[model samples]
Target: MKPLADRIALVTGASRGIGRAIAVRLAQDGALVGIHYRAERDKAEQTLDDIRAAGGDGFLIAADLADPAGATQLSEALIAELRARRDPPQFDILVNNAGIDDRKTIEQVTEADFDRMLQINFKSPFFLIQKLLPVIADGGRIINISSMASRLSFPTMPVYAPTKAALSTLSRVLAAHLGPRGITVNAVLPGATSTDLNPLSDPARAAAVRDSVALGRIAGPEDIAPVVAFLASKEGGWITGETIEASGGQRL
Candidate 1:
């Protein structure tokens, strides 16, 4: 039997990039995925199509994580979908991968920028987990897609880095809170991946990035997906409250 033959997984920001890769990987491992998108319906559909093409199954969910009410909206949609499918309210995996990045220096930061960053990157995930706790199956997995910026300082990512740091801290706290139930909560920090969010379109900049990595190359989203898939599998049950950095030893 497949390791995740009967599992259910929700991956936010799954319309593209790292989230899309993670969602597809989970489906490949036998999970029925819930692919969440904020505004990119077409991209979300493409993700579902990829899942189907791989002989896996999935559905699409839409919710704007930037809004204060977004978490509630997403949870309601998920529960409603499960009910419509005549399945139980519980699911096996939650991947909090939806987030935004503001490439502004501290001097350029404004109140609106800070609030929006906090709302989408940290607050939404926090409350989403709170709202879904009741339905998250015991022995389940919660994987937060954090960033290497949370640990390494980047002057251009002042606000974005902190938000990811908060998420990583939340993972640690929740792991202990949910430990007795046998659930595992973890944070995955991917460094300089070749996603739309971190485009490597500029040859010079891409080369600079590649040279910095100990692996001598920039990572693709596929490189990070397996890490998340492992964390979501039954084999990953014993691990919790940990931050797994898939950075290819950049700057090490």
Candidate 2:
């Protein structure tokens, strides 16, 4: 039997990039994925299509994580979908992968920018977990897609980095809180990955990032998906409250 044959997974920001890769990977592993996107319904549909092409299954969910009530909106939609399918109102994996980075310096960031970053990157995940705790199956997994910026200093991502740091801290705290239930909570930090949000169109910039990595290459979203898949697997049950960096040893 497949390791995740009967599992259900929800991956936020799954319309593209790392989130899309993770969602597709989970589906391939036998989980019925819930692909969440803030906008870009077409992209979300393509993700579902990819899953189907791989002989996997999934559905799309839309919610703007930047909104204060985004978490609630997402949870409600998930429950509704589950009910419509006559499945239990529960899931095995929750991937908090939706986030935004303004790539602004501290001096360039404004109050609005700070608030939006906090709302989407930190606050949304916090409230999403809180709202979905009851329906998250025992022995389930909660994977937060943080960033290496949480550990390394990136002057251009001042506000964005701190939000990811807070998320990593939240993962640690929640792992303990949910340990008694046998649930595993972890944070995945991917470094300098090639995604639309972090484009590397400039050869000089890409080369600079490439030289910093011990792996001597820029990472693709595919490189990070397996790490998350492992963490969501049964074997990953024993691991919790940890931050797994899939950065190819950048700056090491």
Candidate 3:
């Protein structure tokens, strides 16, 4: 049987990039996926189509993580969708993969920028997990898509890095809190992935990033998705409260 067969997964920001890759990978492992998008309805549909094309099952859900009410609404909507299909209103995997990238230097930061970063990157996940706790199945998995920036300093990403650091800390805390229930929570840090969020189209820029990685190349979403898939599988049950760096051994 497939590892994730008869399972359910919800991947936030699944409309494109890393989230899309993770959602597709989970579906390939036989989990029914909830592809959540903030505003890109078309992209979400495309992701759903890809899942279907791969003979996997899934649906699209829209929610803006930046909004305080977003996570609750998303939970409600997800429950409704599951019920419509005669499935349980609970899920086995929750991938908190939605976040915004900030590239402003310390001198360029503002109160509004800081608030927006925290609201979407950290606050949303906290409340989303809180509100969705009842619906998350026991022995489930929670994967937070963090960044290598949290551990490595960047000149223009002072505020953004902290948010990822906060996420990693949350993963450890939740893993401990949920350990009694057999759930595993972990943070995944990908370094300089080639995605729309951080395109490496420029040869010089791409080469610069490649030179920093031990793998001699910047990673793509495909390189990161399988790691998350492993975490969602039964094989990953024994691992928790850890930060798994899928950064091609960058800076190590």
Residue runs of model 2 more than 4 Å from their true location after superposition = none
Q: Put down candidate 1 lDDT per residue, 1-252, tens digits, no spaces.
A: 888988889999999999999999999999999999998899999999999999999999999999999999999999887777645678889999999998999999999999999999999999999999988998999999999999998999999999999999999999999999999999999999998878899999999989999999999999999999999988888899999999999878
- lDDT per prediction? 0.95, 0.95, 0.92
TM-score of 2: 0.98
Query: What TM-score quantifies how close candidate 3 is to the native fold?
Result: 0.97
Error of 3 at 126 (Å): 0.9
Residue-by-residue lDDT tens digits, candidate 2, 98-127: 999998888999999999999999999999
Which pairs of residues clash in candidate 1, taking residues 3 or more apart in a chain or in different chains?
none
lDDT by residue (39-92, candidate 3, tens digit) is 989999999999999999899898888888888888888888877764466788
lDDT minimum window of 10 residues, candidate 1? 81-90
Report each candidate's C-alpha RMSD, comma-separated, in the order given: 0.9, 0.9, 1.1
lDDT (C-alpha) at residue 7 in model 1: 87
For each predicted model, how many residue pairs clash, with residues at least 3 apart or on different chains? 0, 0, 0
